[model samples]
Target: MRFTRLAGLSGIGFVLLLLGGNLALVSAGFPTPSDAVGFDEVARLHADASDALRLTSALLPTAWLLATIFAAGVFAALWRHDRIRGDGWALVGLAGILMQCVAFAGVGAARLAVATTATHDPGTASHDLGAVAGLWGLHNALFGFNQIFLATALLGLSVSGRRAGLVGRWHAAVGLLGAALLFLAATTSPYGADGVNPLALFGLVGWLLWLVWIVGYSVVLIRGVEEEVPSALATP
Candidate 1:
């Protein structure tokens, strides 16, 4: 019931999800939007994919859903102590995180569709494959939206945390830096998720750094201020 403990557990789950998802991706050879070339290639890949690949692909959305819950918990825990506009930042960040989760869920659904229906009737398979390809094409935008909002939320949290004396200025700085990187990486056409090739790399780096910040934030949340903070938020 403790907020900090919840956050810590959430953080741990997130890291585990990240590791597991990537491993699954590797095992499944699931083509990311950034890597796949066209519909035919995607169709072929899906047709050849094993059940493990399809099921593993479903993990992405589950992970993101956990992230959304974590974000809400974090915002609730921090809002109380945050007087210097931290509340607003936390709210915004929560929103961003939620939106990102939705986007990721969308991607996951597309992946699952292939995994679930890849072996159906040829006509169904063709339609599903095309859907997957279209989803992949839009992946950039969906993913970019997440990065942008996530960056905003992180920056807000960092600033608010620093102001509350819950975290150091340097900690906040890292978040800001990470957010900046994500913003650039999030640059994509509004109509689609398309963006510069190299930018995705930058975004990936930024996301990793932000995850590091979350680890620290989880620590802080677990070790909240002594008296005013609730036992649930303060205690591990």
Candidate 2:
């Protein structure tokens, strides 16, 4: 039997495990955007929010780095082995993860900058969160695109063995669809203060599915994987 991917799978597990840390950062002292237009009122909240974001900033980088390294393991397993099917999926997933790193850092910093710029004057309330809003919208917009890559990657993996080429097509198609919606959210319509957007939630769910699939499939693949004749790799 051909060897599956043990090390790569384990790497994915480790990568996903970092999400717990990220969650903790987000929860530390998150701030709520308020409708109030008073600088003084917003300053308190903004400072509180900034403190939380600082923690989050630290968390996201660590999470992203861990995930990237872990994903590299996946690449080694799927790509090095010329497991064309899984490798394609992994590439797509990697794109999303990388984009997330940018989005998280840019947006987090932007929000923090805005919060810092705030003054205690109530008159400046209207402009107080300018930086915050800029980053908030930009980050969410990127997230919209970023999440789709992950979904496409996962979907690709699920159906890779059956039809590598076909799966690639699906990966591109679904990825495009997810990214498109995100683009729309970022540019045209956008997800404003209109309660939670269902599309955003769906994106998250799709990602979770991919993560779960990867972790589960990884276990099965790892158990069965073994070193084999190098010639076998050249067969198909």
Candidate 3:
């Protein structure tokens, strides 16, 4: 199959993974770190013995793996389209995505450790709870850094795609807007501090729109691949 089709399918799958993870967390009543005052509370909410909580913890790492695949597919599509033109942005975007994925995996691992501690050791739960909170803070900090790299990847793709005529100016513009908003959010996130920012919430809105754009972009690429098939098949 064409790289475009692969990218489209991967993008769809990535979105599904995110949605599924969020749903699982919500079903388990998992509290956001902001809501939980300390490690003990974090453990109480997220590291519970309930099956739903375990599912929620598992979904986070699984989602990161899916994101890595999605990023790889996007990188392949971008490189296929722009490499002949000597555009380096595709590689830049790929590097940024890889960084984001690795950092996210770290966060997932930390979260999983906290969950494991909470599940297996009731005797040490109180004593180790503070350490788990520190881990949670580290995870949040990692997430904030991940968003910065994610924004970089998005911006790189937007500029490169527009220059290569792979996508329209307006489409690229929307991507730029989304990336800018995310960058702002990343900068204001305070390196994973617990308190919230209104700008970060606004950035979340942009992120939502940005996700919609990705889905639409993937559909366009998939259709382009469909259009190419007949011509390739008809060639002698």
Instruction: Provide TM-scores for the models.
Output: 0.78, 0.59, 0.80
lDDT-based ranking: 1, 3, 2
Better-scoring candidate (lDDT), 1 or 2: 1
Q: 1-236 in candidate 2: lDDT tens per residue?
A: 33345344544654565466446544654332212133344445556555665555566555666556544544444454444644465566556555555665565665566556643432255564554455445544554444444544444433332232212333334444544444433333245443233455445444444555445435534544334223322123
- Total clashes, candidate 2? 1
- Count clashes in each candidate, considering only residues at least 3 apart in sequence or on different chains: 4, 1, 0
Model 1 deviation from the true structure expressed as Cα RMSD, one decimal place: 4.6
lDDT winner between candidates 2 and 3: 3
Residue pairs in candidate 3 whose N, alpha carbon or C atoms collide under 3 angstroms:
none
Tens digits of per-residue lDDT, candidate 1, 119-147, equal 45322456776665565556545666668
Best by TM-score: 3
Best candidate, lDDT-wise? 1
Q: How high is the CA lDDT of each candidate model?
A: 0.65, 0.47, 0.65
Candidate 3 lowest-lDDT run of ten: 227-236
Which of 1 and 2 is the better model by TM-score?
1
Clashing pairs in 2: 4-225
Model 3: per-residue Cα lDDT over 1-236, one tens digit each:
76667667767777787777766776677654334355566677655644675566666655666566656666555555534257778777667767876877786777677676666652355567766767767766776666777787778877766655566666777778878887887787774445443366656765675677577557656666345433431222
Q: TM-score of the candidate numbered 1?
A: 0.78
